[model samples]
Target: MAASLLQSSSLSLLLVVLVAAASTARAQLQYGFYNTTCPGVEDLVRTELLAKFAADVTLPAGLLRLHFHDCFGAGCDATLLLKSHNGTAQRDADPNSTVRGYEAIEAVKATVEAACPLVVSCADIMAMAARDAVNFTQGPAYQVETGRRDGNVSRKEDALRFLPPADGNVTVLTHYFAVQNLTMKDMVVLSAAHTLGVAHCPSFSARLYNYTGAGDQDPSLDADYAKNLTAVCGGPSNVASVQPLDAVSPTTFDLGYYQSVATHRALLGSDAALLNDSLTAAYVQFMTNASSVDTFFADFAVSMINMGRIGVRTGTDGEIRATCQVYVD
Candidate 1:
């Protein structure tokens, strides 16, 4: 009986040590910056490429909105990584936003499935996709940490609340990020995302028609383009305006948006606010006149890190759902 007790005690001690080692290892993965060498790091890279390809197609805006929703509040919590309800449950009035590129998510999933099977989470995939959108347009490819688990569901109201409006003003935007623990500096850097893509005529018709006459008309805009924008927005009374995010270089990702804003040519109310706000006014001046591209690049890298860390779920807080939109064990 004594021998049996000794054997049991020895076994318990071994189990305890093993548990301690595991705890230490997991804790190490929980915080701090991780490079591409970290576990599942390559998955993010591959997923980013897939996301870019998906963005090229017709994707629902809601999916993209969900990604922004989570990132705005909690870095990249992988909330969109949950699987859809498999059509089993009664559909809620507000299903997950499909504005995000589903084709992109699916493409990224296809690649991940081939390599790691279901190990990759959808939430992480969307985070990578956001980064991909920035980087593909010539922005900095900042290092992002991997190993975030998938969220079990997407909520519609959640997306609407977090996604910044297309024409959100400086104060609304300032308070919005404040709720997420972000600063004006961070907002300025992220807003530089305008360095990519084109806005449809319908999206910004208000500015073209109403012409609040806040800033001078865009001298650089082709007369025909302005006229066309006016027509699409339904004459002078309509408040919408269609302008490329980066008037100087819409297709390339750079700090030129700052240059435009400093010149009073900022296309969006939010972009113009960087200069209007007293707190971020100096940083806008620095970006506009600074001689170094390196300065902008460095700030952008830090901002990217901040964005990736928003709304993250760690330890025992969030689940790794089997599907990105569903709540299943």
Candidate 2:
């Protein structure tokens, strides 16, 4: 009888230990994680963004784009913030050369750091700043998960390898998003972000001067729209200036981008490629109309939250950098 009782006790204890370990892991990431440590982290981020975003309506778009770029290269690890140890920072990658909003992140980071010394991670700050930017731009507001940590490494090669190129076709873009465990629909939904940002002239010049290197415009592009793009965009070699992806409502987060894409007015070939596929084309048609604006916003929110989870580091896996722009020396 005593032997059986001892065996039962051991089983109970093992169960208890396993449950405790699970709880500890859960603590690594949860909503209201900083309710005690930094009660005002979200508000601080929003306030800082309001000031910056209000002054420059375009700021939110770039900030949101920056957040996505970070997630793509390293699962929202804040690797993009790592300063170049030797020209290796992800932010300096060619695809990311035009990414903006570092100063905006600094403004919010300063506020969070003031109240909660080492309690908040820069990765979380970035996630929240991105959410606030979207909300500030009249996009859908969504809750972002926190407790991510700053990664120690940042390589330009990773960014180049992971980011979907402006000239990528539907198949290439689909594969890239799939690698992140994101579906083709997620790729189409997130493309709604193009509603607010701009593309460099070099990114889409191929559709103008040389769709196939014969100095002929891409037939896929609407001829009238191509002419308009040619006028606004610089030469194939010109990287100095950028043109808005959605000129109709450049600063607004609406369905105008999908409308632009549906008509072959999208700034990047990747954007134009959406129309080449039946599935993606359906999304473009549905989102372009006013009735689907709310749906698009809601879909964008879900995808953004999903994107924020890519390759996240939490639970003592990485350090919380004192400054967001570099690994701790």
Candidate 3:
């Protein structure tokens, strides 16, 4: 009984420590962090993004993906925005090859700089832009905390090690999220971002052509959907071809991605793997119901806020870059 009590006590202490750490991380950022320094920072980013997005409706997905990729590499420090000095930056990684919106981010940064030069960090700009991206795409509008600083280092190897793969199974994906202090529920909710993006054929082509290297399609994929994808994608070599991750309502930020996952019509193997885990699977199933739309939106906003805190640099830890594409001298 004494040994059991000791073990339980240890576990409780560990939980407390974890909770404290998370609290500290969140405390380092503030909802109105730039109000004093860059009072209209969010408004500037949103305005620039809105103008760009009006010209191209797909801009939201690119900005959102860009933020996710940046956060995953060196903790939301905007490392993904840095240009590869010797072809070694995070943006050079295979997983990040499809990530877009660099120009948009730079454009927003320029606007912010014009008003409050050397005051706002590119990292915060990305976090805020992602929030606005969701709101612009008809998703929930949530407040994003700022005060993130840009990291000086960005390695392609870090991106390769950190970013979850398109073909990752539930086990692989869960580990990635856990390393970032995110829950499995966050994994499922964030996967709904797929609803707004278009994926290149190379991301999911293996499942269509060679499931196990035997020239077989993924049996778990819906047959009719697979047929349609096969027609759209042609073969694995057709890397240039692209398809909407959510066919039903590709432009809207809704529960359509969950519906696709629940029906085994998920575009990426990793998306389909959500059904293999009990916790994530339950969330996927729950989200498929139209009534659960509000719940999913709220959850997504919370998850995004949580994700924005990962490995964050603040309070003189990193520098605020003059241009997102290059480090400050």
Candidate 4:
């Protein structure tokens, strides 16, 4: 009788443990997920990014965009790091062609693995790397939730459809963000990441050379600003060259991005589109002319937290990748 009683208690306890784990995996991520599992994960990612960013200031922006690409593709599952044998990885997408800092991610995976063999997920590493990238660039130090799992599926077509286009308008951009369960405010705040990166000519050349097939420039672009862009991008050998997304403070992370947009100097049509809608327009204006960086920083952090939670796989759904670029055997 005692043996049977003890067996029943053991089964009940096992069931309770399973339920708790499921709740953790499906529910919200926490801030201290690694305190016991791998205490040095965040610090390792931070140190790596700091050294990398010092050598290449552009790295922070690259990793920031990398994070966006990762999340948008498969719910922050680190699918962006996958390497397909067919050469059709998420990074191969046209929109992500210029994204840098993959090496930094790989380095982080190696460092994290050395300390904690298989406890940390690549998804969490990606989240921390992105957070470190942003904070290292004079941006806010936001708390990143951990406990995300690494995803296995990454398709080239998925990225082409999901990644926001440079030419998207207010309506198109709004719909895209909405599909991801993000607000227009989140879209605007995230757009501020453009302050640090460069765009290839193909991204904005349509506005400069041919808005329509008949050879007309986009009327929305400031005439003088258009002229300056043409000078920089119109050269015979410059069509393929790169231009800073934020001409004001190209390397600094600040409100200058909104200021540029407010002044008709934004390079991407989607950026300029924020001024077309009443709600987004107010955000752009306030962010542009507002003296305090506190609100923007706070909003950005909140939005990032929200963005990081999209469609994540926890519990036993996805596996912890042995490397950021490949699945485990």
Q: What is candidate 3's lDDT per residue for 136-202, written digit by digit as tens?
A: 9899999998888888888899899999988898889988999999988888889899989899999
Candidate 2's C-alpha lDDT? 0.85
| TM-score (all chains, Cα) for each model | 0.69, 0.91, 0.91, 0.89
Q: Which pairs, if any, clash in model 2?
A: 75-310
Q: lDDT by residue for model 4 over 29-96, one digit each (tens)? A: 88879999888778877887789889998888888888888898768998888877766878778777
Candidate 2 residue 46 Cα shift, in angstroms, is 0.3
In TM-score terms, candidate 1 sits at 0.69
Task: Report lDDT per candidate.
Answer: 0.58, 0.85, 0.90, 0.84
**Model 2: per-residue lDDT, tens digit, 1-329?**
99999999999999999999986675456777788988978887888789888899889888888889999998788888887856777987898888998877876777778888888888888889888888887888889889888888888899999999998888999999999999999999998789897888888898899988899988988888787777776567877777889866888888889988987788889999999999999999988788998889889988988888888887868777667886433
Better of 1 and 4 by lDDT: 4
> What's the residue-level lDDT of 325 in candidate 4?
84
Which portions of model 3 show Cα errors greater than 4 Å?
1-27, 327-329
Considering only N, C-alpha and C atoms within 3 Å, which residue pairs clash in candidate 3? Answer: none
**Which residue window of length 10 is worst by lDDT in model 4?**
234-243
| 1 against 2, candidate with superior lDDT | 2
Least accurate 10 contiguous residues by lDDT in model 2: 320-329
Clashing residue pairs for model 4: none
Question: What is the model-wide C-alpha lDDT for candidate 4?
Answer: 0.84
The alpha-carbon root-mean-square deviation between model 4 and the true structure, to one decimal in Å, is 5.4
